[model samples]
Target: MTQKITIDGKDYAVGKLSEEARNQVVNLRVCDQEIAHLKQRLAIAQTARAAYASGLRKALASAEVVEH
Candidate 1:
């Protein structure tokens, strides 16, 4: 088996690496309610950064991107 990994535009040899690299996104609670919580957070964050905070809020409000 030939497996290669490229990171940061550089090739890194897998030395003492894990046999399986798995990433798990665990949502402790339902995201629907979390969105409201995030909105409140955005409001607090927006006070410090108007433009970027608004941008984040806008991006979060929009529909999820479809990855094909």
Candidate 2:
């Protein structure tokens, strides 16, 4: 079985690429994986931030009721 890679809407066999091209393909794959990981982390951090904001709001509201 042969592995194929697509670039610019065209498909080419990985085995036919030069060593430099193959290395570049590997780099592109690594970068894509890293980008996906960072996106997930950002989503998690945003969710946590939203939770923290909500908690702060509730705490402040409680404080105001106690002071009245």
Candidate 3:
């Protein structure tokens, strides 16, 4: 089966992709999606770590030193 694609008032023809091309295209799309998810997770972790560090610093500063 073939397909017709139109772009900017121009008509283009695309035929069925070969097996290798189909596999690679699908793999690339999956990899891109995985990368996007990982980046989002990394950002969330970094934000949480920063907030934790800031809280720790504040707690340490407010601690009273007891000389016994």
Candidate 4:
């Protein structure tokens, strides 16, 4: 069976790839979803990191100093 794939606004024919190649394509699609999820997780982590840094800075500024 033949399948058409659209890439860059152009249609290309992709058919009868080897079994290994087809498996690789399927694996790549799964990896793509994982990458997307990781990106979202990274964004949340960054936000948390920024908030922690801000709180740390405020805490440092508000700390009591002891003079000798």
lDDT by residue (1-60, candidate 1, tens digit) is 444456569664454335443111113235646998999999988776987878888998
Local distance difference test, per candidate?
Answer: 0.61, 0.96, 0.78, 0.82
Best prediction by lDDT = 2
Give the Cα-based TM-score of candidate 3 against the true structure: 0.68
Name the regions of candidate 1 deviating beyond 4 angstroms. Answer: 1-29, 50-68
lDDT of 1 at 26: 19
Clashing pairs in 2: none
Give one digit per residue, the lDDT tens place, for model 3 in 1-68.
46654546965443555677566666877998999999999999999999999999999899986788
Q: Residue 24 CA error for candidate 2 (Å)? A: 0.3
- What is the alpha-carbon lDDT for the whole of candidate 3? 0.78
**Between candidates 1 and 4, which one is better according to lDDT?**
4
lDDT for model 1, please. 0.61
Output the better candidate (2/4) by lDDT: 2
Q: Who is ahead in TM-score, 2 or 4?
A: 2
Clashes in predicted model 4: 0
lDDT of 2 at 23: 99
lDDT of 2 at 17: 98
Candidate number that wins on TM-score, 2 or 3: 2
- Residue lDDT tens for model 2, 1-68: 89999999999899999999999999999999999999999999999999999999988887856553
Stronger candidate by TM-score (1 vs 3) = 3
- The list of candidate 4 runs beyond 4 A from truth reads 1-15, 66-68
Which has the higher TM-score value, candidate number 1 or candidate number 4?
Answer: 4
